[model samples]
Target: MVLPIVKLVILLARQITRPVVHRLGALAKRNRTFRSVIVPIGQGYHSMNFTSQSRLFGVDTQTQAEPLSTDEAMNLGSKLLGEVLVYGVSASFLLYEYHKSSRKEKIKAKNRQNEKAELQGKIQEYWDVTEAEIALLKRKIFELEVKNHS
Candidate 1:
């Protein structure tokens, strides 16, 4: 019973790693960058079995493209450089607007401080005069009511 179970586990392990083995095989086959010591010396390849090769190099299949040429690489670089310049100019404009708004905020806050100082003394004088008049009227009304009751 244990022997059968061990065999089954071994088969599962092989199934799991099979894809990884095939991908490494395909990458070494296609890209020169990874072709160094991993592939055996002088072991030539037969044509790729279609399913595995399609799965491995899905986008780069004969339909879409061949490898990039030198001219293509140069064109791609120039396009990227133009995009960088546009982004730099946009960023500078945004930074200038941000500083302008911050300066306006500082000026507004200074004006508010001056207005508060100008109004505070006038407001305090009004409140004091109003309170004194209200107290005198209340005392006069109380005295008149007391005399009428007596």
Candidate 2:
């Protein structure tokens, strides 16, 4: 259950991010300064996903690499922390909105049900009144018939 909810959140996040990514890419293409700043950072992030870099974080690999310097470590840590915080906040906001909309839908459904029941009750009342009127007319016709026969 938790896994499915997490997957749903991730799916929603991807849907939301795709458009923003496209717009940012277009902006970066049009702006040279932005391009200069973003391109290298993008490249570096892309490169970090490789198996070679995976070894740096103690993943199983034969090649031995030097540990990061203090400044590099600090920068990496802060960037990671920033990313975690951003994603956490985004997920929280999405969950809140989802909850709110679902609550509203529930309320709407309940109101519709109540209205349906009320309408049914009104129809029944009308049917009863019509039946009573028909019975009264029948009794009046019987009395007129008796008078005519006498």
Candidate 3:
């Protein structure tokens, strides 16, 4: 259930971010400064992907930085925006589910209270009937005793 909802939220976020990603690509193509900044970040990302991450081997590898292609910049932008959107959507969904569950629990508690009240009323009625029968029997016994003694 949670997995499907999360998948749906991610898909929706991706769809919503598509236009913005395209715009970022266009901006990267037109702007040299933007490319300079974004490309280095992309280069760092690329180096991390290609390079060995283990430091225990004491392997010191130097990575060459390359300019990011427009497509790469656009993809990076898309990923960033998509993740943010997904987080926001997922959080909102969780909060809504929490509130819904809270309401259901409250309703369940109220029902339990009602049932308890009804049972209490029934028990009180039974005790009342028992007391009334005891009183009548005692009076009959007293009258029979008085007749015999007389």
- Top candidate when judged by lDDT against the true structure: 3
The C-alpha lDDT values of all candidates are 0.57, 0.68, 0.72
Question: Which ranges of candidate 1 are over 4 A from the true structure?
Answer: 1-67, 129-150
Clashes of each: 0, 0, 0
Candidate 1 weakest lDDT stretch, 10 residues: 39-48
- Give the clash total for candidate 3: 0
lDDT of 1 at 20: 51
The sequence of per-residue lDDT tens digits that candidate 2 reaches over residues 30-57 is: 7777666555554454445545577767
lDDT (Cα, 0-100) at 79 in candidate 2 = 47
Winner on lDDT (1 vs 3) = 3
TM, every model? 0.40, 0.53, 0.55
lDDT of 3 by residue, 16-92 (tens): 77776666657776888776665665566665655655343556556443555656754674455445666777789
Model 1 scores a TM of 0.40
Q: Which model is ahead, 1 or 2, in terms of lDDT? A: 2
Better of 2 and 3 by lDDT: 3
TM-score of 3: 0.55
lDDT per residue for candidate 1 within 107-133, as digits (tens), equals 999999889977997798888998999
